[model samples]
Target: MRTVRLPGLERPVGAIGFGCASLGSRISAAQGLDALADAHAAGVNWFDVAPAYGAGDAEAILGRFARGKRDGIYICTKVGLAPPQRNALLKQVYSMARPIVGTLTGLRRAFRRMPSTRNVSLPLTPQLITDSLHSSLQRLGTDHVDVFALHKPAHGDIGRDDIQRALQGLRQAGKVRLIGVAGDLEAAQIALANRDTYTMVQLADDPSAQPLQQLPPAGGPCYAVVTHSILGVGGTRERVLHALRMAGPAAMSEMIRLGYSPKPEQAVAELLLDRALAANANGVVLMSMFGARHRSENLRRVQGTPKPEALQWVSRLLAPVSESRE
Candidate 1:
């Protein structure tokens, strides 16, 4: 993977980042550390973690694993509600609900526990952003973060000059090399367009999902771009092939039946890489390559065969659909 530059960041990061969301949640701490070590050894420089993941265990584990290698990595973390402390009741509630009910009720529970005012937080705000940075630094045992993002803000939270001011202050203090916002791209675009506060932007540019219009380059010096969920997590190959089958794409069906199989893992990855390149993205945050077997598979997919010349094909496939909507 090639490294790309972000204007204010002290170091260029690898094209593929390691997302730590699943590390402490679905995996054990020692195993997560092993995965981190594997990623680091494989030349992956970007690491993305969030407070909302694993109730702070993921960051703690990453900090332990990254102890002496601070300068060699680009550590990116988010500020948001920390994952709730797990309880038997909450576990039982989650297990007994239908999928939709589970989602809605879980969200409601989370919202209920969130601070009513944005200013009141996990550590309370004497300095707000600075306090959060110090807390993250202490946990990660680092002097500075390469990129720090406000994970996701409330709907009416826009135009909050206080938040903007706090982020700018972080940059000046050298606590964070760059500032960014993460969530839906539309909100990110609105933030970047309306304010010059952020140096880089992170968003998904995967093809399978409804195409999101890319924000035109911000010009001048800027962090290239970092994105996640580019593989369209839920848009697996089986789902896509099924859709194509239903639509009766005779050529595609023939290709499928003849064992001209486009491996789901490879095809989806290719689609992600293709779209990111199209969007002029510098790097992406990729997660879930934990086990040694999984790691080997990912490395093979990422580094094995030559990348196809896919831009032209994807453009032709998508142009008519986009044009029809316009």
Candidate 2:
């Protein structure tokens, strides 16, 4: 429930944001709404969703949850992508597959990163930005969203005046409170480089990559940052474990003494998550906490103290290997 005074924000944004990428896809409406309510009850005021999320049903469910509470919460939804239209049979197939995928990690990982066949990114144009925002507004049941973002945009798109001007117009027209770029590290850097045109940047925070090192620390940059993929995504979990195993018993013992779990995977997960929270102390770190367990655990982590030693461990592990002595 801890909050930060992010520049350009009317309200203090929660340190941990609720990620709704699986709202209506892996989770049912009833469950998604309940999760949203639980998060909101726990003082989570930031929600991150997209047009392509939850097979395009997340925004509507979130809109429903936001009824009478829109002013109390901050919403960031993205453009440039839409869900693929699924017929009744395919929808049923997805529903039946959810439980199986939940139990099988391999099946989940296979489809986790695979782009949907029909869900596609649209060409970024002024018309597309305006039209997309209009549709999103209708779905969100809000006239103006807290943040409007370009979904995984290309570098060229970021440089286009037509697109930036379109976003600026949205702000001028009172449709979007702020504009941002949400993509890989490159996309975030691109947006950060053009801070004049972008107000926020959303990207993954990998422990091994330590991409956040490239940016000025929290409260230093004018633009707000929203980081995601703190756990397991993009093989970060494995990389953390790899680093620990290679670092040998002394590092592991230190981690254990520092209150990390002895089990390597869990220890690595905790260290990485703690480091992310510490790194983005003044920013928002997105957590896909659809389940009750994840919600409680992550909220606890958000409220917990930052572990600077954890940050140092990850940075050392991920830092480039020095070349052999001449």
Candidate 3:
């Protein structure tokens, strides 16, 4: 429910942004639209989508949700990586599997690994940049998007003069209000270096790495850092909990009381989210919002995120023996 300032946009963005990567794919339109509406109603104004997202249908569903309310929300969609191309059999299987996997989420990973579900998108080009925005605008049912980003670009793509020009032209034309890079740490670092073209950078918010800490302090640079992949690392929660146990009862109790999660796993996750937001206090954190429970949980987490003491507690708990002693 908290808000952060994002340069190049007239409105301040919500701290928690809804990610539409599963909109039309894992979630049906009926539930997806309702979920999006719920998020918007809960003060989550930022929605991240891509042409490749939601089996290439997320933008349309989001568009349906944003109708008439366009001015109130911020949309960030990306180029590069189009949707997966599937045959009729796969499509039928996907349709049938959606409900099953939704209930049995553990199976989602297995489904994702099934062959030929997604298509490998073409490499970035100036024309693809121009063409993609037009298509995305159409799908999103908006005249312009708040942020248009390159999806997982190669190391060299960020500084390419032609690619830079393409993004700039879109901004100048009002097709996109801001240009950004959405990828890993390396890509984000490159975007930071090429601030002339990139005003935003989206990357994973890993606790071990704390990548978003690279952003300049408040009022120093106008760059908006959007972080995702928080708590996505395998076994991170267990690892943190183990370390906390090693630190003794005080550390565990402090984290649980501060996080306010009924379950230890949820509490640890909330603590991690707090650390990520603290690492980039002025930026947005993206989370997939399809299920009502998880959506509500994430919305609640943002209000308490960037909790400095919680971050400090987790850092000390997870610190190495030598460093923590120091």
TM-score attained by model 2? 0.90
Error of model 2, residue 39, in angstroms:
1.5
Error of 3 at 257 (Å): 3.0
Candidate 1 TM-score, C-alpha based: 0.74
Ordering by TM-score: 3, 2, 1
lDDT of 3: 0.82
The best candidate by TM-score is: 3
Write candidate 2's Cα lDDT for 1-326 as tens digits: 67886777887888999999888877888889999999999999999999988878889999999999999999999999878655344356567887886567788777665655246778899999999999999999999998999998877899788888889999999998889999888888778777767879898887767688787544445888889888746676886688778878998999889887798887877777788889887789999888887788778877766667767777776655562111
- Candidate 1 per-residue lDDT, tens place, 1-326, comes to 55666677656666677888655544567778988898789888788887655445678888998898988988888675556555334334433432443246356445345543112224323275677678888888898888888766553343367777788788888888878776677757756664567766667655554334566565664444667665554444335434444434563554445333355434434444554454444445465576676565454444432234444434434444455235
Q: What is the C-alpha RMSD of each candidate to the true structure, in Å?
A: 6.3, 2.8, 2.2
lDDT of each: 0.61, 0.83, 0.82
lDDT winner between candidates 1 and 2: 2
Clashing pairs in 1: 6-223
lDDT of 3 by residue, 48-116 (tens): 999988777889989999999999999999999877777456556667888798788569877877767
- Clash totals in order: 1, 0, 2
Residue 116 CA displacement from its true place in model 1, Å: 19
